[model samples]
Target chain A: MDSCQPDEKLDLAGVPCPQNSARTLIKLEGMDSGAMLEVIIDDGEPVKNVPPSVEEEGHRVVEKVRTGDRWKILIRRREE
Target chain B: MGIYLDNAATTRVDPAVASEVERVRRSAEGNASSIHQHGVNAAKHIEKARNIIAGSINAEAEEIVFTSGGTESNNTVLKGVVSLSSNEKKHIVISAIEHPSIIETARWLEEAGISVTYVSVDRDGFVSASDVEKALTAETVLVSIMHANNETGTIEPIKDIGRACTERGVLFHADACQSYTKIPLDVKEQNVDFITLNAHKIHGPKGVGALYVRKGVKIAPLLHGGEQEATLRSGTYNTEGIAGFGKAVEIAHTDDVKKMTELRDWFSKELSENIEGVLLNGPDTQRLSNIINLRIRSVDGNRLAAELDRRAISVGRGSSCSSSKSTPSHVLLALGMDSKEAEESIRISLNKWTRKKELGIVVKNMIEIVTELRMV
Candidate 1:
C-alpha cells in the first residue's frame, strides 16, 4: 500500500497552517476526480487537520506517513 | 527538523523552571496576603524571587514591582511617571523604535496634555546619544527608551542617555525585555531610574515580570489596591510565576552568554554566506548577540515565514507580540528600509539551548526554500 505511486507531487513542506490547507484545496480544485496529490508538510497541527478536512471535501487520503518531524500525506480528489 | 529560531518572541520554559513552577502550583496553595503559614511560605517564595531578580539587576528587592509582563511594566512606568507631575515638566521623550506598548502609552500621554518627542534612529537602527540629547527639553520630565529593540535587537545608548538625564535632572527608564537575558544589565551602571524585565523572554513563565524603580524616584501608582509591590503596582502576587522567573533569570545570568554570542555570530555568518539577497538589518556589532534580522529580497515576509514553517524552521517577522498583523515592520521602516524590503524581513533569534546542527539545518533549508520561492 505504501509503494503506490502518486499521480502528482505537491510539496507543501515548509508552509505554515491554514495556508497549507487553503493551497491544497486550491490544487485539488484544479484536478480531476480520482487524481492523486501527494502533500508534504512539517507543521504538526495541519497534518492532523488537513487530511480530515480534505476527505470531507470528497477527497480520499491515500497515505499518511510520519517521516521524522514531517508528515507525507497523499490525497486523491474524489469529486467537485 | 522543527528548529525553533524565534527566541526573541518567547522561549520554551526550561524543564527545571517549569517543574519548580508546577511544584509551587500543586503543593503550595496559599495567597501571599493571607495570614497563615501557607501564605507566609508563598510570601517567602515571592520575596526570595524578588531578591534574586533585584540582585541580578543591581536593584534593591523593595524597589522591584511585579506586573503581568513587559507591556504592563511599560504602561505602569509611562503612566505612573506622567501622572506624578502637574508642573511644566510634562514632556516625555522616547525613541521611534520602542515597542508598541511604549509607543501607545506615549500617545495616550499626548492625549492627556503631555508633550512627546519621538527620537529617531540612524540607518543602522541605533538611537544615537546625540539624537536623544537634542530631544531633551527643559520640560522633559522623563526619557523612556528600550534597552534593546524587539525587531532589530539593536542595543540603544542608554548609558549616555542616562547620564544626560541625570545632568538635566530628568528621569530615565529603559524597557529591557529583549536584552535582559542576552546582556549583562546593572541599574547602577546604566544610571536608569526604572527598568523592565519580562520572564517569558528569558525561558521563564509568562504573565510575570519585574520593574526596577530606583529607590528615590517619586512616581504615582498605576493601580490602586492593598499595599502590594510597594504600592506601585496593586494586585495579588503571582508567586509561582515570579519564582519561575527568578530561576530563569539566575540561569540566564550564570549561563554562558559568551558561548551563545559565538553561536549566534556563527549562525549569522553562515546564513549571510550561503543565502542570496540576505541583508542584515541592524548595526553589526551594536545589536544583541542572539538576534539576527535578515531581509530576503523578492519574497514577502509572510510567505517566507510560512515557507520556513513548512521546513520545520520556526522564525518570526516584526514582533512576535504583533504577529497577527501583516503590517510592514515599523522598526525596519524607521531604519530607512522601504516597505517592500521591510515586508521581506524576518528575525531569527537564538538561545543557549539552540544547537549548531539545528542552525546548520535551518540555513540549508532556508537557502533551498528561498531559492525555490524566488524561482516561482
Candidate 2:
C-alpha cells in the first residue's frame, strides 16, 4: 500500500513526553486491528521515544516524515 | 526526577500528610452540616483541623474561615471589603509586590467603582509603613499587603504597617500564603485584622485555604449559599484536604525547616561564588530561607528553565501558576528590576527535606546550562 490513509490523527507537538507517548498508545489501543494512526510530535524527545515505544508495543511504523522542527509518523496497529 | 527546587510554586506533599489525607478520604464520609453521627464525627475532625491551623497563626479557631485557597481567601477580603464599605469609604490600599490574587482582585474592584492605591515597595521589596501611611486617604477603608512576596521572598514590615492601618481606622489584610507556617505569626501582636493561609505551599494537600478574620471585623461573603464556615464561605467542606492541611501545619512548625535555612544559604553562596553573572534579587538576610530568586545575565529565563527540565531538574522562572501569561513578573518589576532582568530571573525554592547532594546537581547543571546558552 502506497500513501495509505490514516484512521486517526493526533497532533501532539507542544505536549510533553511520556504523557504524549502514553496518550498515543492509548489512542492506538482503542483503534481496530490493522488501522493506521498518524501522529505529529515535537522534534526531540517525543520523536525519539514515541515511534520506538509504539514498535515495542508491537505496532509497525509505515512512514516517518521530518520537517525541520516537527515529526509526523504513521503507525499501523498490529493485527492480533 | 533529578532535583526539585520549586517549593515556592508548590511542594511535594509529605508522605505522612499524604497518608493522612488518604485516611480521612477513606474513612470520613459525612457532611459537617448533616445531623447524623457520621456528620458529627466529620465536623469534629474539621474543628480539630481548624484548631491546629489557628494555633500556628496565633488566631482563635472561630476566627478562621475556610476558603478554596489563598486566591479565594485574598479575593474574599478584597472584594468583601469593597462591597461592605460605605459609598464614602471605598478605597483600597495594596502594595505593588502582592500576588496576582490580591492585585487582580483589586484591579477588578477598581473597575467596579472602588478606588485602589498601589503603594510601591523599596528597591529591596519592602513596603515601609511610611509609604503605606502616605498612600492612605480619608476614603481608604481597607489595606492589603502580603506577609512575604512569592517571587522575591521579601518579608514586608507588617507590624509597622499594621499599626499604621490600626491607627487610621483602616482594616489591614495580609496575604500570608507564602509565610503562614514558616514564620511566627501573632495576629494580635502584629495588629492585623485579616490574614490569608494555604496548605499546599507547606507540603499539605492543595485546594484548601482559610482566611483569619478578627472576631468583630465585618466583611461581606463572596459566596451566598448554605450556612457553612459561619456564612462567610459556603460550600461543601473539603474534609480530607483540611485534615491534611492541619497535619501539614503541625509538621511544619514542630519539625521546623531550620536546616533548610542553612542549606539555602549554602546553595546561594555556592551559586554566587561559582556563577559569574549571578545577582540575588531580594535582601541577603531579610528573605525567606526556602526561596532564592536569581538573575543570570545574558541568558533567557525560559530557556534556562527548559534546559533544566530537559535534564530532569524542575525549577520555576516566575510565578508557576500564572507564568503562562508569558510576561516579566510584576513582583520583580516592583523591586525595580527592568523588564530584561526580570525576564532573565528564575526562582529556586527548596523544601525542608532538600539535601546538599541534590543541590550539587543544581549547581553543576546551572554552570553547564548558563555557559552553554551564553556561547550560543
Candidate 3:
C-alpha cells in the first residue's frame, strides 16, 4: 500500500459515470495545488471512465485499488 | 443586458409577476399545510393560483398539483404511472422528440423492466397521431407527447393523439410547458388526462410548476410528506412562486401571441432572404409563434452561438436546457437530421418583450457572421 495520505476524500460509489467524473472535477477544483484527493467510486464505468477524465484535466491519478464492488482512486489536484 | 432570444429555455420574469411574488411573501409567513390563520392565508394563495392555472387549461382547481418545475411534473407523471399500474401494464408510448425530462425518465424506467416505445418524427419534427397509435400496445399504460417541442417548436397533434389513447384505454399526458398560455389548450376537448405546465417559460418565477391530472385519474405520488397538493405532491407550498405563476398566466394575452407570430414570420423571411443556405428546422406554420430554429450550412452552431454572445445577441444551440453537452441535439437527430446537420442548427426563441429592432439587429449580425464563418 502507498504510504502517502490524501488531503481529501470523496465517496462517489453508486454514482453513475459523467456525473461521478464531473463531481470529482468539482471537488478537485476546490482543493489546493498538489493536494491529494481519495475518491471511492463504483467499479465498472466509474473505474474505466473517471481516471482518464481526471487525467484529461491535467491532474494526476496516483493509484487505484479494488475494494469489493467499489474502487478507491487517488487523484492529485493539478498545480496552478 | 444583451438581447436574449432563448425564451424557450426560460424568460425574464415580468415585473408584475415579481411584485405579486413579493406581496405573497410579505403577506403570509406560514406553511400552507397547517390549519392556523397564517397557514390558511398561505393556502388561500395556493388555491387561487391553482384555480387560475386549472382554468387556463380547462381543468378543475383540485386537479392541479404544484411541483418544483416542469422536470418534476414530467417525472411525477412517468414514474407515478409505472408505480401504480399493474405488472401487465409495463409499456409506455412517447414521441421521439420529447424533452430530456421525459426521454431520460423513460430510460430510467427501462432499467426497472418498463418497456418504452419512442415513435418517430418526420423531417419537420412533427409527431403524427397515427405513429403514436401504432406504437401503443395492450400493455401500454400511458402515451406521453408534448404539445409543442421546446427545441424545434413543432406542435404535435395532441388532440388526435389524445383521442386515440382514450379510445385504446390508455392515459394521455402532454408536456405543455412550452405551449401553455402561448396557444389554446382545452383538456376536455383534447382528451388529455394529464398535462405538465411550468411558470418560468411564461415570464414567471422559476422553481414553480404544475401537473394537471384529470379528475378521478389515479396515480402514485412521487413525494411523501404533509400531503400538500391533494396528496399528489407533498412539501410546503411555494406560495409566493405559485402566486407569481398565476399572475403570469393571467397577464398572458392572445394579442401577444399574434404579435409574436407576425414578428417570427418577418424575422424568418428576413433571414431566409439574406442568409444563403439557411433552412428552417421545423414546420413553417404549425409551430409555436415564438420559436425559430434554423440550420445554417457550413457553420458550427456552438461557435455561432458563442460568436453571437460576444456580439451581445444571445441565442441557443439546440435546447438551452441541454446546451452543456457537446453532443448534437437528440431532438434534431430524431427529426432525421444527421449529426453534423444537427450541430449546425441554432434555436432563436422570441418573447413578448422582444422588439422588432432587436430581431432586425440579430438578422443583420447573423448574415455577416454566417458569411464570414463560411469563408473559414
Candidate 4:
C-alpha cells in the first residue's frame, strides 16, 4: 500500500452535475494506478450517480459513507 | 425514454424534422449568398422556409427576419426598436414576469439611461391591459410583453394591450417564444409591431428562430455583416436548421395540441387530488395547455427535481436557465408567492408525446417523493 491518505480530494457538496461528476473524473484522470481519491458530494443523485458512473469508466469505488445530508466516497483509479 | 416533463425548457426534436435537417445538411448545398446555381437552390429553400414561417402566423414573408433563436430575436427587437427612436422617447414598458431575456435586457437598457416601466401582474400572473395603458405616455416608445410567460405559462391579453398601444401611438412587441406553434397568433389582428418565434420549443432544431417586424416599422439592425436577412440580421444562413424549423412548423397541427391539453388537465387534476397542500401558480383559464407550475408545502424545488430525475422523471423546477442561482423564481415571486412557496415550486411541462400512463407514473412518483422529502 502506498498510503492510506487519498492522493486527491474533491469537495462537491453544492456543485451541480455534469460539473460535479466532470470534476471528479478529471481528478481521477490525473492520478496513478490504484491511487485513492476522496470526493464529497451532495446527497441523493450525486451519491447514487457518481460512483456507478466512475465505475463504468473502469475505476473502483472502495468506500462510501453518509454524513448527514452529504456523502463521502473513496474511489481507486484503475490500472492503466 | 425518461418521462420528459420539461418540455417548456426545450423539446425533443421531432423525428421527421431531424430527418429533414439531416437530408438538407447532406444533400442541400451552396451558400444562400452565392449567385450561382447552388446558391440559387439554397436561397430558394430559405425563402420557402420564410414563407412557411410567415404563413403560420398570418404575416407576410417580408416581415420575418430569421435570427439565431428566441434570445437573439428578443434582443434584436428590443434593442433595434428602441435604438432607432428619438432620444426624448426612450421609455419602454414590460410585464414583471417576463423571461430573463426581456427582463435582463430591460435592466441593461436602464443602465444605459433609458426608462423602463415594469407593470405588475395579478395573483394569477395575468398582466392587466389597463395597467399597461395607464403606464404609457407620449415619451414611451415601445411596449414589450410576453404572449405567454415561460414559468407560469400565463397568457396575456395581447389584443387588449396591443390595441391600447396602437391607440396611444406606441409600438407593441411580444416575446412569443414560449407560445409559438403551440397557439395561433395574428400580428395584424393583435397590432403587434414585433414578435419573437423559436423552433426548438416546437420540436424543431435549435439555433434558428425568427422575428416578425411589421411593415413600415423602421428599426436599426442588430447585426451588421454580409447584409443577410434584408440587412437587419447578418450572418450565413443556418439552412439546415431553418429547413427543420419549417418542417416542424408544417407538421405541427392543432390536433396535437388538443391531446396535450387533455394530458395536462388530467395530470394536474390527478396531482392536485392525490397531493395535499398542492397550490397552483397561475390562472386556470387563458394559460398555455402544456405547462403546470405547482407548489408543495414542504419540499424543496431543486431537491425534488433531482429526486424525480433519479426516478427517471425529468422535470424542471423554475427556469432551467437560471436554476443555479439560489434565489427564488422571479415569476413566482411576482405572483405573490412567499419565499418558502417559491422554493417549494416545481414546474411540470407536458408535450404531445406525454401519455395518460406517463402522467399516472409522474403523479405517483411525485406524491411519494414529496412525502419522502418532507419526512426527511
Native contact recovery (fnat) for each candidate is: 0.00, 0.00, 0.00, 0.00
Off by over 4 Å in 3: A1-80
If you superpose only chain B onto the true chain B, what TM-score does each candidate give? 0.97, 0.98, 0.99, 0.98
> lDDT tens digits, residues B85-192, model 3?
986759999888899999999999999889999999899988889888999888999999999999989998999999999999999999999999998999889999
Writing each residue's lDDT as its tens digit, candidate 4 over B227-247 gives: 887688889989899989999
**What is the clash tally of candidate 2?**
0
The whole-model C-alpha lDDT of candidate 4 against the native structure comes to 0.86
Which model is ahead, 1 or 4, in terms of lDDT?
A: 4
CA deviation > 4 Å runs, candidate 1:
A1-80, B253-255
DockQ of each: 0.01, 0.01, 0.01, 0.01
Best by lDDT: 3
Native A-B contact fraction in model 1: 0.00
Ranking by lDDT: 3, 4, 2, 1
> Model 2, B101-209: lDDT tens per residue?
9888889988988889999988878999999999989999999999998988898889999999999999999999988777779998999999999999999999999
Chain A agreement with the truth for model 4, given as TM-score:
0.91
Q: Name the lDDT value of residue A53 in candidate 4.
A: 66
Ten-residue region with minimum lDDT total, candidate 3 chain B? B32-41
How high is the DockQ of candidate 3? Answer: 0.01
The CAPRI class of candidate 1 is incorrect
State residue B72's C-alpha deviation in candidate 1, in Å. 0.6
Q: Given the true complex, what DockQ would model 2 score?
A: 0.01
